[model samples]
Target: MMSKKLWEGSKQFKEHSHLHDYKLWLATSKGLKFKNYQELWQWSVTEVEDFWESMWNYFNVISHKPYSKVLSSHQMPDCKWFEGATINYAEHLFRKAKDNETAIIFGNEAGINQDISWLELKTKVASLATYFKSIGVTKGDRVVAFLPNIPEATIAFLAVNSIGAIWSSTSPDFGSESVVDRFAQIEPKVLIAVDGYQYNGKPYDKSNIVNAIVDALPTLKKVLVLPYLNTNALDNFPKHYENINHIFNTVSGELTFEPVAFNHPIWVLYSSGTTGLPKAIVHSHGGILLEHLKYMAFHNDVHEGERFFWFSTTGWMMWNFVQAAFLMGASIVLYDGSPTYPNFNALWKFSEDVKIAHFGTSAPYLVACMKKGLMPKAEFDLYSIRSISSTGAPLPPEAFDYVYANIKDDVWLCSMAGGTDVCTAFVGGVPEYAVHSGEIQCRALGVSLYAYDDHGNPVEDQLGEMVIDKPMPSMPIYFWNDTDNKRYKASYFEHYPGKWRHGDFIRINSKTNGLVIYGRSDATLNRHGIRIGTSEIYRAVNKIKAVEDSLIVNLELEEGKHYMPLFVKMKNSAKLTDEVKSQINNQLKKEYSPRHVPDEIIQVDDIPYTISGKKMEAPIKKILLGMSLEKSINFDSMRNPESVQFFIEFATQI
Candidate 1:
């Protein structure tokens, strides 16, 4: 049993203790009052219908067509949410129109700040909407963007959604082939591009690549170029392409918004596709908008006029999530350059300057900050920050400690877990919960999550496959161009019969009432029929000094048996010596079983990652197995793909 002191001290648990109107409705509407997290979770699975129905009502999700039924049946694969409901995703997001409120604050490593008020944002979106309508762009038409995470990108997204047109985008850094691989498949009617982008004190000219991609895609009707960098290259721009100003000039009258069905496609977000071509995960208008609001209002506790900043690119799902803040009348902060370009304190400086309330970033960014040994508490006055959210990967326990000790004493460290597939979090913070050490506070409200053992039974206080037993409103409507739902089923439902397998190896701690996400299940290492998470080895290895980061892979022997091999990347001015390798081995053997010790340990200069900043483990595994390196789906932000050849050479030698 959890101690009373721990529960009360928890920021999340204490906030929900009082019986608010919403809380009362959730408790009685679904009979969800439980003695503990376990009881509430178990009851949620059994009473899936009541749980979701109550959640929709509790959140006050506006719908044109009321849901005739909450769920279809007990079938996991076929489970549906808000059945027969019709709603406009953009309308819900724009519900907050209170005058002159700050809607967006854009920044960069060069210390540039661009603030946009709600009224200004609305005007720009309306103008963009008028342009789209005048150009024969209508509902269901695909509008693709290859832009940075600037205010214009967010405006374009809202404009596309406002007119019921489907929007898809990638960061400007994506190569021509990678961009072509995705946008070509969708046959987008309109393409949005920027001339160039600035990153890490360098200017990258994407106009050439953008011109090349537009030349290849025959289905593209028109290309709209935004004058980025204030360069006079507009004349040098492609003759076939039209300037953004020209498109808006054609739009003359008041904007007219056409509301579509609840499941209308809003955006087509592609997977990294390191192994093959990327999968286009299509999210619905209602699902993305409503789920984001749920997370923003309830999970992040974002109040009106608060400043929100998340360092992300247009390629990342966080960019999409951050744009939703405009709907809440919050100031959405956007940064375009490297987080540590001029100094390690760039982001901190921006936070202080903007007086941000909610700050979101990747775990690696925090880990990198900790590695630099720079303390923000001493450098800057960060009294404005109330919450700090970390995602992209499992936050190391040491980073958690570093944050609490240096960033803020009373701020909530919300370690969120979800993927681009859903466009929102499945497990994250609720204001009424406590922040646990190295754990996400709680499963998202209304998301029926469970940890199931191999026997398909729910497990408690143990590591198991993370699955959602019931459907939620945020579940993807379908895969793009997948008429038969074949790709959708194969992606999520093929692992488990009916349940939504989230593909994470996680453990729910009954003692602390928190969750520990070990790593991705596909990346799980198998030794002597025992499945162990790779993060288990990382946790042990990262604890050692001189080791900045590490990656572990399971190598198959001649007999088809797998053995574990480890790779380490040392800190700057540090090397992985024999002593360091021995120390890592000793720690692994002592903490885990003897079998957990890797067969070999090698050092590498750097690790390859997806555009979204996840370590590309599957490609490394393929390289170790002597397989061809398949083209990456989103290669724009991918750094150092050639480094994998070093791993391949080391694998052959071993």
Candidate 2:
């Protein structure tokens, strides 16, 4: 099956793809016919309501108030989508606002690249939705931010979803106790923050963590701020402050669009959970506008004046999945510091000075640029990179032969995985398949993904539990104050009742039909009875170039004792020696077995991630199984809460 294809797509380049003009508009509108892309993803998940009413009539969706049907209750926590749709996810990203095009392209760590236009992004989102309706704000209210991937955080999240409010954000390097444990569970009412942030070249002012998240958000009522890195930051705020550049130069008006109600609440996105208080989730505004117009026209083909770029952080979910490259009129490129600041070829020279064309990142930043053997195609001009993707984790297949041997043998590496519970990707990249090395090149179109087995059936290439049986128009329409749905039915339908397990650990590769994942099935790694998958010990410790990062876990003691361990994090003065623990136990006993090595190898000066970089493996296996480190993690949602005090002092010597 995997005849090692690495790149493919040609029937005259898949007939100038947009998924081949959406399979010739579903064969001249629904006469249908699909002899590939797995029969158009099995008729898009077995006719999920005539494939979401033909994706609201092949994306001409401008419904001011239409959807009265097209799925109501098909299962999982009582499904309901498109019920009386009133649309307006920021009027479909300014529905073709083409004034001087280039809508957003920033950059930071003071490398500088700026640009904004679409008539200065629709006049700064109509002067921040006329200063959020002159301070009273409205429709669903909330609002949030502490902001960073700038263009004033996508012009204040398209002016707080163009007035039907409710947005959320975090990244001012979090910590005001993780931005008041997720904007004090969404009781926001406008905060917009940021008088800080520089990173890797250091600045970090955060006016006392924005004056302690404006004195721990007492249902805020306007705060604004934004003098990025202190210009006497409105002389230090907190008495109901203001200034966000004087309300974007004196609040102009008329950028209206509040049609809402297609499952309203537009953003919230949290859940990098290492300990409680994070799952605010939410997502709607027509389930992320039909899942970002079907994930940017079928798993990111994202064309129209394309520029894209996704080295995210306005607290990750790929910055709301790179604003789905403004739903295909593309452009989006933001940066805001540290993609290895002034090093690791700063985002391949910011994707060769911004001719990006769908770059997106993370899979441990392509395994730390393939363990620093960095070539990035001999330093730049990546031929306007068409596709490079790689989502949060589980990529390791030698970072897919280091991107076709040093970052670009005609790119297209993808390697995706979905998270933030469906902010997109349920398996990724589908320009009509064939980019094999580490898999994941399909399964997205209407994602009814499988790989179940542990008795929940649906198997395929073994290693299971990554369910999802249908229901996805970007999943979460709940979570904010999660009550009656009881933490959204224990976060993903209590295991397998109606499906959607999604705590990772996938497989389904039947030789490149694609999808491999292998990570978080709640940090699984049984050992002697075999269960593994910490990306199979990070693809055998990312083939040990003096292992610069690693984590592994296991634990499960008593009567069938397991333990495991590993840890690593070496590089610089590279000492983990004993010949690097016998070359990491003979590369996990020659690539997987010897029960995939371990039972303690330790070195650790780093590891514990999650400020969206993830890999805090179920909070370090709930702190080496004795739990309690404030009940296993959440040191302000940690990026390195001091690399978690050497795993809480090696969890009290095991």
Candidate 3:
């Protein structure tokens, strides 16, 4: 069935974790005793208010004012955490910086860039924040950035947060319109952007895209551009633009912090825009601050001054999450280019060179390494890697085997599953536990997650909907521009009526007491380990006159393989030619990225729809995965009853 013990924590490993220290403090200070992790976890979720308050006290959260209440309401869509508390998230990042030898390590695909010291980082952040204030950027004002995974992105984010202004960002690779769709909704006052970026050893010049994006956002007051690729990047712009270098050149002002409420919005992270537009999900400063502290120290088991790196772009949530390593006083590593530039050994080589302690990446990257059969342990010296974390997709059991056998024998592999909806991991690793194959070590403390069946009943040891019965602090404050919290409630609470339905299929094995996530339960496209919405794809596909209608689905097969096929309905018996396919692929790439291009294009009679006139993507996804036709579709609820049979026959052939 499964291989024996992938990895186990030694006695030293258990004692070295933050969990050990916290438990000791609990017993000494609060007189709380627990036999094992489950007992501790039980106390965490059961007594939610007391548990979170302990986290606040244990971590010693520096607040401008004391909280009147730990939690105002326990219900979803209304939980006001740490109400009446005033705190600044950026204040904590500097607590470990006084011993500042180095705060951040920067690297590119080819080699290491410059290492930024904590003093330098503080200076730049102060300078930028001063510049922002001079330009009228105030608290709660949105400042958006279009950049890559670089030191500037981190600096800008910290600067924005330090001044109590809101922050939002996406990768520079996004098409101009796609960027507009998300940023326009927020009505950001300032635009921070890069001219271009390098990926897979090739340079992408986005000077025109930046100009186009700026043109679309009428609310933008001032545009500051980074000459990342060409020095004359701003020369081509139609209007005058401020050089981003001005702030760096000037000596910074006195670094200051603005005290805001605990529930004040820190940053806006985007969803896949699956329905219409990308949901601008907002996370509070204190919520993320608390969550990140717990996750980085306890779950990841990272010590201060250790080098932490996760391969991520500015667009992804992990990029934001990676910054939390600062809360642990860890040196965060930012690598800008493709993970597999010269070869698959690119990131691995960088890890060895940088001596990264916490190596964070996606499951797909690990699977690729397994397929290539590249022995990283043999090829490079990865002795500094204390732990490895994978997210954005499920890590197959075989990939777990590969890590122990081929990468590092004793290294801890923490395969966690969470989304942009929550900036922190819902279920992740516990340093005190054994590393079981294909199982997340534990559900995060203070998160009440359970596998629920369709009838809203919690089920054990069976695949069911991932639901959270208790409110987490890191849950969204509200969607940007959402009126009366309507969209926010519908996105999460509508499914189960008060309980958050996370749209992920998961099962908790009774034997291991660990979680096994089966990927998203909905129609969101899981390509390249990132969730993409169908609306973005359909927007590009619709431009083709030959295609009248279309539907796209991502099928998660065995061996960590993903099959995404786009079924197109031709217009008026029009032919589906090679030219049409090329047009579709190019448009998607131009609009989004290469990941948006589907693997296969097949002609279909029509696309399926529900009785409410919404695209019936979830049912088609189940049918193509070989579920029985009767279970996959109900004729009474669909707009077209007979359209689904073609997919049923087609599934057998594939």
Model 1 error, position 618 (Å): 1.5
Query: Looking at candidate 1, what is the lDDT of residue 371?
Result: 74
As a TM-score, model 1 comes out at: 0.93
lDDT value for model 1: 0.78
Score every model by TM-score. 0.93, 0.34, 0.82
Which candidate leads in TM-score? 1
| Ranked by lDDT, top first | 3, 2, 1
Compared with the true structure, what per-residue lDDT tens digits does model 2 show for residues 126-217? 88888788778988988888888888888888888888988888788878887888888888877888888888998878888888877888
Report the C-alpha lDDT of model 3 over 1-654, residue by residue, as the tens digit.
Answer: 233568889898898889999999999999999988889999999999999999999999999899999998888888899988999999998778853588989999867678999888898998999999998999999999999999999999999999999999988767776688889999999999999988778889998888889889999999999888888887876556888887689747878989899999999998754334678999999999999998898899888879999998888899999999999988999998878888889988998888999999987678668766789999999999989999876676777888999999989999997789998889999987888887888998988999997678999877778999999999999998899999999989998888898988887877667888865678778797676766557657866767877888999988999999999988786889999999999999997899999999998888886432346687788788888766666554444657877898889976
Candidate 3 — which residues are off by over 4 angstroms?
Answer: 1-3, 523-654
Clashing pairs counted in every model: 8, 0, 0
Better model by TM-score: candidate 2 vs candidate 3: 3
**Ranking of candidates on TM-score, top first:** 1, 3, 2
Q: What does each candidate score in C-alpha RMSD?
A: 2.8, 22.5, 10.6
Find the candidate with the highest lDDT and give its number. 3
